[model samples]
Target: MLRFIKFAKDALLAFPLTLIFLPFSRFFSFLYYYNKLVIWIWKNKGDVTYHDFYSPFRDYKKRYALYENILQEQKLKEESICYLEFGVASGASFKWWLEHNTNIDSHFYGFDTFEGLPEKWGSFDKGAMSYKIPEIDDSRAKFFKGLFQETLNPFIQSHEVNITSSARRIFHMDADLYSATIFSLSQLFPYLKKGDLIMFDEFSVAMHEFKAFDEFVSNFYIKLRPIAAVNNFYQICFIVE
Candidate 1:
């Protein structure tokens, strides 16, 4: 009886270990194949992101509301104010914003590599080189190609959207990478007005982004404040007024 009891205990302990090992092994295999799926999606659709990359239903609602509320609170009087988004994935957010806001006069611009992140990312992995997205046909919408440093300032200058010294009324940063997000914010931060809005889609996940913003605020003593926090694990919205 004693021997049987000892044997049973050992078997139970070993059972848990076996269970853990099997799931962990399966999990790694799943992760490997999942990454492959992402790469495949990017290859075929360089212009738009693959939906499987992120949860559309759960993650998108808060962001959409944030944009809508910002526009409402700012009370932007222009028939169409210039709005810019950095790192547009799949153009899904752009499509949602355009349709919901119905600011016929508002010109929405998105900037991306469309080919994915550049090589030699300073602190992060380069995103895939491309994605396929639907054609953004809203007269108020446009897409710019290349990196932020290469495309943003020049595009703003050409459009003559710079009022006084600032370039656009609203800007959304979703680059996800540290260098790209910081660079985009630095270049455009100067142009943000007292009533302008800027949203960061990766404020939490990307340590670099949070660190960069903290450093900038400390150095410049900027007064940007959070107006809406997406009650989630990631994403935050800020308003400068």
Candidate 2:
């Protein structure tokens, strides 16, 4: 059976048809992961107890609600927490959390290229969505300006103890690229604790953030229990279990 399967595979690739299919390999691959994404959602949607799934429209405002819902559920609004936000374009979400938490001891770190995305995301070019980092008045908040691949490791090393400290950890993964999202998750997986929170700004996008998330959870065997999902799962929050 194995021999037959191998022979069939080799014959397909050795044929002229392979050239035609090769050009559309990415298209075919997307269908596979898109189907996987839909199936996974179908099977696990019931497990997400606090979701506003299947909304008729997408509203960016619902992200704040997602944040509030999780905070109210976890009772961490005023708690001392370590908040790390990846892809802090314009710093809107970063400022929102910083203002909402009101905990002086809660350290907020925002990571981004500030110049724009490190790679192209769908229609957006490599430098699309580029914005200068917003200036915030709080001393508790700091911005790391560079690629996650370059900056994250150094930050992790310096704050290794603080990362695993008593303060609650909340990671806002707003990076829309799979490469950025996956790299950030993989790097932070070892530091993730049971109570830590992980939110994806683009969880429903099949090819990028969703792909990274599916791979991260599956590959690491990390049980991330969905807590809140808004904007048709465009913004989903999970708690490490």
Candidate 3:
């Protein structure tokens, strides 16, 4: 008799909540299936392990080579360029770009919380990738220590003239959450132009990076063409068309 009463009480509590959320659940279910169909029809399926979009280099460093080739082909090496990186945990990738771009006129900016993610990301909690901001040691490379939404606008406004004058813009997105990626993309949409390269570090995670990119492009009516990608789909680079 006690077990039956407990079951009844639990069902009674859940009944109203389920009624309140039923519409939302149905709407999300429709969106999920719609997005799946769209991706299946539109997404490119290239060689997962290697692609020679620009260079023949087919190793772990292929992505870097592809970036270099894009820069060269676009003649951005001789012009001022803007390199923006989101989620600069240890500043490793930011430093690599600074060292490799080798253009005195190029400017690099990195944005991160430095304390890690603001919310949970799959197996990672709120503070999963926290790290101390490393000294970039380069005058052209600067770090903004805060969330992207907080720091991006001010930084962009301050450097609006320089950024607009730059011949090429590159964006590296390492933020591993859907919300972060989508928000950063939306914020940066106005500054993006043809020939700009956007590299996603965690692109393969279907529910996060991929979903964010899909929504961003769809909402903005932006055209993106895949230029390079890793075998496991962990990283992918797309050029704004």
Candidate 4:
């Protein structure tokens, strides 16, 4: 029986699976993560999460409500937070934080291409959702006008001491593509600390943000406990526990 089991495992490993499955891998990967997402939500959506499970129509505006609640609950409005936003497309959320925080010591860093996505995302073509960098008068706000791959490291190197300071850290992951999301998270992993906040803007999209997030959590073995989920987990917030 042991010999047969070993033979079966060897046969499976030896099989030229990629030749047959590579074409449909995209679809299968999506299905697999979709199911994993559902399961994750069901298991983790405990009494703690500010959840709305049966949202009929997703209102992107609800993210503002989510922002409000998280800020209020965390008492972060007046705190000096290192606000790192990966996707600052129109700067709506960025401005929202700037308006609410009221902390002069708090620094806001926005990273983006300011042109559009580097690659195609879902139905949106490459370079879709393009916007000029928003102009702001605040000296506290700094914009990195390029891909995260190009900018984050240099920023980190320059601001290492300030970022790793006792100031609160809030990382807002609005980059919609899995590749971008995963890249940002993995790069940011080493700097993550307990009680730091992380958020996902397009979290319910299983094949993209969710897939990246799932893998990131699993890979890092990081302790991230979900605090709030709005729009049926489309926009979810977690704290590094």
Backbone clashes in model 2, listed as residue pairs: none
Candidate with maximal TM-score: 2
Off by over 4 Å in 3: 1-43, 46-79
Q: What is the TM-score of each candidate against the true structure?
A: 0.65, 0.95, 0.76, 0.92
Which of candidates 1 and 2 reaches a greater TM-score? 2
Name the better of 3 and 4 by TM-score.
4
> Model 4, clash count?
0
Segments in model 1 whose C-alpha atoms lie over 4 Å from true places:
1-61, 71-79, 119-125, 162-168
* Candidate 1, position 181, lDDT: 78
Q: lDDT by residue for model 1 over 1-241, one digit each (tens)?
A: 9999999889989776556577588567546544543453345333321122244445556666655565566565443566788888688777766775555667788899887777544454566636654497677888888888899888868875433334336677777776887788777666667867777775544244565565556666676766654534246666675
What's the residue-level lDDT of 62 in candidate 1? 68
What does the lDDT come to for candidate 4? Answer: 0.92
Candidate 2: where is the Cα deviation over 4 Å? 8-17
- Per-residue error for 98 in candidate 2, Å, reads 0.1
Summarize candidate 3's per-residue lDDT along 24-124 as a digit string, tens digits: 98568657845673463345745222343333343666557655655666566667778889999988777777777767888888889999999998789
lDDT of 2 by residue, 143-217 (tens): 999999999999999988878789999999999999999999999998898989999999989999999999999
